[model samples]
Target: MSNYVIQADQQLLDALRAHYEGALSDRLPAGALFAVKRPDVVITAYRSGKVLFQGKAAEQEAAKWISGASASNETADHQPSALAAHQLGSLSAIGSDEVGTGDYFGPIVVAAAYVDRPHIAKIAALGVKDSKQLNDEAIKRIAPAIMETVPHAVTVLDNPQYNRWQRSGMPQTKMKALLHNRTLVKLVDAIAPAEPEAIIIDEFLKRDSYFRYLSDEDRIIRERVHCLPKAESVHVSVAAASIIARYVFLEEMEQLSRAVGLLLPKGAGAIVDEAAARIIRARGEEMLETCAKLHFANTKKALAIAKRRK
Candidate 1:
C-alpha cells in the first residue's frame, strides 16, 4: 500500500468530509474526525487539519487536491490536442459532454451537439462556454437557443435505472461512456448525410480506456474522434452540449422535486444528506429508489441520520 499525507485547513477538511460523506466509516480512530475506506484507497482526516491517504490509488486520489501533483502526473490524453486547438473548433464537429454524475439527486445527463463552421461565431455570441461558469438560470436561458440553432441528442439515465445498473456492477465511467456514445450515435444519425469533420468528447478517461469501455457495444462511433480535457474551451459545440445537458438535468431535478414534494439540491454536500434524511422521514426509504441514486454514499449517511432523528 502507498501512503501520502497533506495538511489542509478546516475549510478544506470540512469540504473533504462533505465529499466523502457516503464513504464514512463507523470505526473512527481516537482524535480522528473520520475514516473512509474505498476499494482503491483509504482516507483518514484528523482534528489537527491533517489528512492521510493510503492504498494503491492513494497518489491518484491525492493528486486531485494537490495542484502540482496533478500537473506533474498529467497524462497526454488529458491535454488539449493540437488538432482540437487549431482546427476542431472552427470546423463542423460533434461535441459531447455529461452532467449530473456528481449529484446525488439528479439523473446523469449526456448530450452531443453538432455545430457547423459558419455557426461557430453565432454560438459564441450567445456567451456559450463551460457549463460550470454559468448558473442554472443562465443555462436555462441559453440551452433553448442552442437547441433551436443546432442539431443535438441527449440521454438521461434516471436514478432507478442508474441504481439498478450500479447494483448490477456497472461502473459510472462505463455508464457515461455508453451514454456519450449512444447520444453521439443518435445525433450522427439525426444529421445523416452531413458528416461532421470531427467528434470531440470532454475527456473523462484516457482515449484507450474510453474505446475499451465501448468495445462491447454493437454500434461504436469512432471516426474522427478526439478526447480532450476541458473540451468546451476547445470548441463551441462542447460548450453548447454542456449547457443543454445541464438544462435537461435541471429540468429532471425540478420534476423529481415536485414528485417528492421537496426541493432537491445539487451536489453531494451536507445539504443533500439532510434533504435525503427528510425524504426518508416523510416518505420512507423506498422513496429514495425512485428519486435519488441509491448507490451513493449519501444513502447510508442519510439512513443513519434518519435513524438517529427518530
Candidate 2:
C-alpha cells in the first residue's frame, strides 16, 4: 500500500469533502474534518489543513487533486524512515505492543494487530487508546470489540516461563523483544498473502538493540519494522494491540488470583509485596514461580516481609 500527505487550503478541503461526500463514512478520527472510502484509496481530511490519501492507489488518487511538483507522496518503499516518522498513522500497518512487563504479577502479554485505513474508523469507534490510559474494565470491554474488528495475534509469557528464561541470563528486554517478534510473526502469517504497508512495534529498545537481541532467533521478521516510542498513540493498530494484551494480562491475573486464593496485586509496590507475602504464607515460596515474576525486587521484599511476620 502507499501513503501520501498533502497540505490543503479550506477551499480544497471543502472541494474534496464535496467530491467524496457520497462516500463519506462515520466515526472519523479525532480532529478529522471528513473521511471517505473509495475503491482505490481511503481519504481522510483533518482540521489541520492536511489531507491523507492511503491504499494501493493512494498516489493516483492524490494526483487528481494536486500537481506532480506539489504532491508529497511518501511511499513506504522509497523513504522508509521518513515515512515511519511522519505518516505512520496514515498507512495500513501492523502494530504490536506489550503489557504486564512492569507489573509484579501475571504473564507478560504482547499482541500484534493489523489495521488498514479502511478499518481506522471502526477501530476508533471501539474506543481504542493506550492501555495505560484505560482501566481493567474498560480494557475488557474494548478488547473483544477490537478482536472482532481486526486481525490480531497475542503471545503470553507466563510467570514460570518468564522465570526460567530470566534465570538463564536473559534480560527482560530480550524476553519482550522475542515476545513482540513472536506476535508480529503470528499476525503476519495470520494475514498471509496480504502484506501491510509497515510493521510498527511500540518502542521498548533502540532499533539496533531490539534486532540484536533477536539475532540468534530463526525466522525473524525485519522488513518494514519501525520501532517507535509511544506508538500506540501513533496508530490505532498499536492501541488495539495494547488494549488486547492488557485485557489478557488482567484475565491471567484473575486466574492466578484464584489459584492462590488471594488477589495478586499489580506493580512492584508495597501492595504487591504484601500480597506476595500472603501467597508465600498460604502456599509457599515456590508458588510464586507459577504466578509472579520472581526476579523482581518485590520477591526479595516479600521474602523479608514474610520472614518478619513469622
Q: What is the C-alpha lDDT of each candidate?
A: 0.86, 0.85
Residue by residue across 155-227, what tens digits does model 2's lDDT show? 9999999999999999999999999988888999999899998898898876667888999888788887877
Q: Could you report the Cα RMSD, in angstroms, for every candidate shown?
A: 14.1, 11.1
The Cα error of candidate 1 at residue 96, in Å, is 0.3
Residue 80's lDDT in candidate 2: 30
Summarize candidate 1's per-residue lDDT along 126-240 as a digit string, tens digits.
9999999999899999999999999999999999999999999999999999999999999999999999988989989866689889989999998878777788987899999
Error of 1 at 117 (Å): 0.7
The estimated TM-scores of all candidates read 0.74, 0.74
Off by over 4 Å in 1: 1-84
